[model samples]
Target: MLILWICFLRGARPILFIDGCHLSSPYKGTLLAASTCDANNDLFPIAYAIVSAENNENWIWFLSNLKELTGSISVTLISDRHPSIIAAVEQVYDRDRHAYCYRHVKENFCVETKKLQRGIRGEVKEDAKKLLDAVCYTHFGTEFTKAVEQLRAFSPELANWLETKGDINKWAKSQFPHRRWDLITTNVAESFNSWIRKERTHSICALITEHRDKLANLLYIAKLEMTKWNNEVGPKIDKILMEHVARSEFLKAVRYGDHNVMVRGSNVDVCVNLLRKECTYLEWQMTGIPCPHACAAIKLLHSNIYTYVEECYLKSSQEKIYASSMIPIETHDMPDVNNLTLTDWENNIFLMPPTTTRSLGRLCKKRRESQFQDVHVYKCSRCDQSGHNRSKCRNPNPEKI
Candidate 1:
């Protein structure tokens, strides 16, 4: 069994994913373990496990081994929020040392909400967005409570989801500012399934052993390629930067040119465009490799924007640096094989025996459900009671009949 985690910036594509695999089966106790991290830009195996015998204690032992490997006092472990994971975290991690992947909860909540709220439109959509935005982007405080109360007025079903005995308390504590529902999901780990799909012809152990090395090799090579590509692209980036500098100067000098006329990078006046969006920096930040608008503004003021933008965030930094600190270091003094432990599931104690075999059919049964929930079910506070939300929830009392 394997558990993988993908962590990403909210509203940004994922760039970090970690995976941990257990060698044992639910029915038997043979336990093995391994883990890897993929930045998509590169993949590296951070840890590995070898199960010598059948024991259920292997899972917890394997995780304990991982804690040593990870070297973090407070690790933000994210997964599908699997029941086993929740139970495991509670059992192992001390308070405030673990967090449930709110992303998974939001995903389930969204799916359920959509099923309940059907065919909602216009202001209803806006209201639903408000409620979700409240949870995703607001701190769990008075404002968040207000947002939830707002949703209650929009739809009874939504109000119930927020207020459910099991949900409200948990959701409140898990809430954070600037987080988004889409930020959650193990999609990055899901991507690796394809990597091993064609190579799964062998049994589980064989598949893992073979691909484990293969993945390690691939990651090493990928880092090298990323370095080369980043260097290769440097000249192109410099050229673009130079172009922005020239354009900014030309735009400033020319007063005779029509504002709407076609001119590369000079269409808008730099001084009068007060809205940041109307400025060049914001525009180029979105469409160009570097902030050409910042480049232009720099040239217009004879200031060095290069110094302002950190080298780390520069396009030039595309080359991934596989810091030796990030992975295990090879030292002669280090044991050829580190400490190993085997656990017997029956007694939850250490034991040793030959590896046992179980059918992969059981493994395939636990695949995640692929479904997108309705968007309407997450209604706004204004429209909670009636079919209509705040924008459309007119106070129409029936005539005195």
Candidate 2:
């Protein structure tokens, strides 16, 4: 399997989303990856290493290498609450620098609560989940404490699990010691695994080679699109700014001083400081872009709203991300080094099938998915319905059910 990471020595954020995905058949190992988003908010791979398994020793070695690469630059690592990962991050990085994935935390809580609160009313269970969400997402200490207490009131066991199992300062955005640039999950690394899914079954050499080519193509395509951006910021950031602008029109701004202003919305009144690019809402701090309230304040001063956006979202910064060039590989008309040249690798290396006795039921065709993930439904051509394909479809007619 192939693992990859984007170079964060320049325009990328100091935060990285790290995770491991299991390799498929013919390869017995795991691909440990660390990834970051570029200025345009696109996933950029830095480096990757393959290991025999996801264990403490392997994870430490992998993260220690990351430490060396990041040299003196304190960085934050985000991922699920995996025991090996938590232990390894603590050894290789600062305890404060390691952050847990909020999705994983929430989903884990949901799954565990169901087991713990068996036979509980659905309404009560749902209300407990809402309270947990507030606890996980609240930006203020007072709000956080109140949410936790409310959660404890409804489901003390689940609340205890959250506090004892994970640290609030690590997962909560309002509490993180440093800026994560809104990267709260390991989904970027998971996406990398899915991108290289086709290569998982291949030999290590072939997989690595294909990954190199794939990275080159991805960079080349992004570089081409960079030339087409017409605004001060990249397309997506510009779109975000436009959205904020639209939302700002509905709110009212009250000037406190040159930059300090109070933005009052229907639900809440937020204090916005255009000079510092800050808002009481905290979205400005997380995303590095002015929230709608901040935008409303910016509009009051008649300042160019584009200037309020972070430098990382600027067009120049996005260009810097793709400034490096990747050398092309001449794979065509190359020397035949496979079966034709010698005996054979793919053909000669044959293995026997499993020797286990056949089971009664049909063999499972798809991999098991995580409970948090949404299951994809396939439509059947024969029945013109969802959940099954034309072949191996149970119902042949649409109305036959």
Top candidate when judged by lDDT against the true structure? 2
Return the number of clashes found in candidate 1. 16
lDDT of each prediction vs. the true structure?
Answer: 0.44, 0.80
**lDDT for each residue of candidate 2 in 1-401, tens digit (9 for 90 to 100):** 12232335766677788898766656557788888887778888887777777889889998998888788888888988899999998888998888888878877777888889888787876787788778877777788888889888887888888788757788887778877877777888888888889987876767778888898888889889988888888777888888989999999999998879999999889899887788888889988988899888888898888888898888777777777767766768654555253344446443322122334899665887777678788987777789778786886356643
C-alpha lDDT (0 to 100) for residue 301 of candidate 2: 91
Which parts of model 2 have CA positions greater than 4 angstroms off?
1-7, 121-124, 329-366, 376-401
Worst 10 residues of 1 by lDDT: 3-12
Candidate 1 per-residue lDDT, tens place, 316-364, comes to 3433333221233344753222343343244434333436566556565
User: What TM-score would candidate 1 get against the native?
Assistant: 0.48
Judge candidate 2 at residue 136 and give its lDDT: 70
Off by over 4 Å in 1: 1-43, 48-59, 94-103, 114-134, 137-147, 163-183, 229-369, 373-401
